[model samples]
Target: METVRQRQQRRQSDAAAHRQRYTNNPQLHKFTLKFSEDTDVGNYFASHRIDVTNSTICNHCNALKLPTESPGMCCSNGKVVLMEPTIPPLLQHLFTSQDDIAKDFHDKIRFYNSAFTFASVGVRFDRELANAKNGIYTFRVQGSFYHRIGLLLPEAGSNPHYLQMYIYDTQHELHHRTNTIPNSNLNPAIVEDIKAILDEVNPYSINFRYISNFPEEDIKNLSMLIHTNIPGLDQRTHNVPTAPQVAAIWINNNVPPGAIQKRDILLRTRMNQLIHISEFSG
Candidate 1:
């Protein structure tokens, strides 16, 4: 029977411990890779020098550097792969944004070490799905995600950092973002690349983590904003829409003429899938 204060203390202690671990070992946690076809994956990996070999050290070390008829690319290490024409940054930002600025809506997020930004990532094969095809493979990429959290009470102590886990998925969040935005073009090449990646996945699980860094004062202001219900707080009528509703309305109102015409394209694509499934029988 832990009291609320005791629980808070425990959480603080745990957060401190997590931060300490991250400081000692920094890594990447949340990341994505997008490509249209098998060739694209190969090219990206080749360009990045991503090695698939199990040996930690290069066996051929200096042998491959010499000019010879049969020279070997003895680079035993490489970086993670990401296609150039993947989802644009806007959608990525939107996916990772704090939609409501003043809401008391905060989720516990973690960071790796003391880094405030992303860095090099490594991969670890958790388990391979037998269904890998078209350049898509279901495997875990080892990376570190970091967040620096400030205490609700500044006097309470140091802000904690954390390192979190990452799991991969092929559903491709880019499509969802493109669908939601008005007047956005669906590039066939990009779509094909995304589809190719999606086809490669037969995932056992995909974890969605919402993590961010914020200060204590920001938390208080957010709490006040949410508690006050500023979206509905109109000096005259008190009938204003909430923050999210306002955002939706703005998106609709600001849609370009071209976007309106193409708006149904994504919707139709989704509906057709549903219709096909509904018509199917076991």
Candidate 2:
């Protein structure tokens, strides 16, 4: 296996070679060389890169200090050069910053992760067959999402209970109508299925939160409230619903089509609302 240092050296060499090629033929590889931080450094990165801090989480320690150099390439700030047919001067004159023009073409090129669940949301672009006729260059955008279910499970010592989860695409007026996972905590099959779905959607921003569902009985009760759309559940003696206290979460049940709503559903328990433990009708 190649060591980390060796990998870096190889990458640097490749970048230097790429830069050298661009230098020989500046007109052909102008965009790739445009963002070179220095002529000497190979493999110029064009996107915005975020830095890490000592407080970031790791398996060994949370406070471990990391070196200043980033381990890998950073995310791009949504900028791409239109290398084909080089837009007409009339169109080029309309934009000030190349970045702004990229934005104007695809205003919604972004990704997000919910802070309340292990779901990542992002956009996917395909360049294979974009604007072939017009001599223009572009991409086909597809919505994508990824979720990790294990993170939201209850701790080993906690009382075991049945749970169900679903994902909704607020942007497209679509949802996983069926229960995506049933009796989730007790079964490993649900995790496998969820991974499959993640591969299918392929969302860009995946957000994970320390979230777990209320017991099956609790979710059934909350579903009743949502179904009825009750003005308010009595809470005089009840504690305000907060994180780690939710009953259940479902997205896009009744929202209007093509509407962008908050992606998370946090269900919490309020003491004022009655919770009855019903006997199973086996």
Candidate 3:
């Protein structure tokens, strides 16, 4: 029995084989002699003495690259969703700011692979959803996520661990700053201060990640609907409203003069280009 993983691997292998076969001979049965390769496009650019800015090595796939064409899309295309977290403005200050105060957090980032990872805790389970007789158990997944200072695990009897700092500060951490960090002079305050910065900028990181992921998913979904048989969502693209449509909702009562000029121009241009073409007689 082929598992889900095995089926996915097999499909991928078949796709690679098919693409290789097409690349070897790109001839079509009755097409207008149009053809294209499936791999290694960089070689063609190199042969033509064209130096492309993007590297031939894909940063995401690492296994495939089409630097001259799609730098990162050669492998995943729209199937894989890559979520890039937007760094909050305040978070970037620690890394780039040259202020004397911010330099403390900046050093820890360079020295240790220090990063912020917050976990949401404590949610009330709805009685209707948690009915054991019907075998349904779920918790409401909603809360305000924030960063903390101490070890990842909550200390015993601590209601909220947001402000609790690890007093021990361990030899590995304490000695790390004292021995190697600049202006240390056996100072232990660096550890606590760094943690403080991470706590304050917690929500910024979450918002950034969600914003980046929110659109990439829908855009990829829109691509799939291009070939769909559905009428309304075809190339009309009603999923995302146009600028004019969005603006019209706000100023429904009083539309400014010349407001529809841009829309009128587009309509006129489309109408002009719709000329009847005579069939070719050979």
The most accurate candidate by TM-score is 3
Tell me the TM-score of each prediction against the true structure. 0.15, 0.16, 0.24
Best candidate, lDDT: 3
lDDT of 3 by residue, 102-175 (tens): 66655555443332223223343344434444333434333333332334323465322222122222223344
Q: What is the lDDT of residue 86 in candidate 1?
A: 64
Candidates 2 and 3 compared by lDDT, better number: 3
Candidate 1 C-alpha lDDT tens digits along 1-282 = 999999888977986686476445533222246666555565556454534343343344433333332333453332323344665443344346666421111221111111212122323333322224323454543343322322212122322221211111213333432342234444434434333343344121111122223333564522212234576576565533354322111246777666644221111232222111221121
Residue-level lDDT tens digits of model 2 in 152-255: 33345542212212222222111221223332221223233333444344342122111222234554522222222345855554443443334444465787
lDDT of 3: 0.44
Best-first order by lDDT: 3, 2, 1
Residue 38 CA error for candidate 2 (Å)? 17
Off by over 4 Å in 2: 1-117, 129-213, 221-282
TM-score of 3: 0.24
lDDT of each candidate versus the true structure: 0.35, 0.36, 0.44
Total clashes in model 3, counting residue pairs 3 or more apart in sequence or in different chains: 0
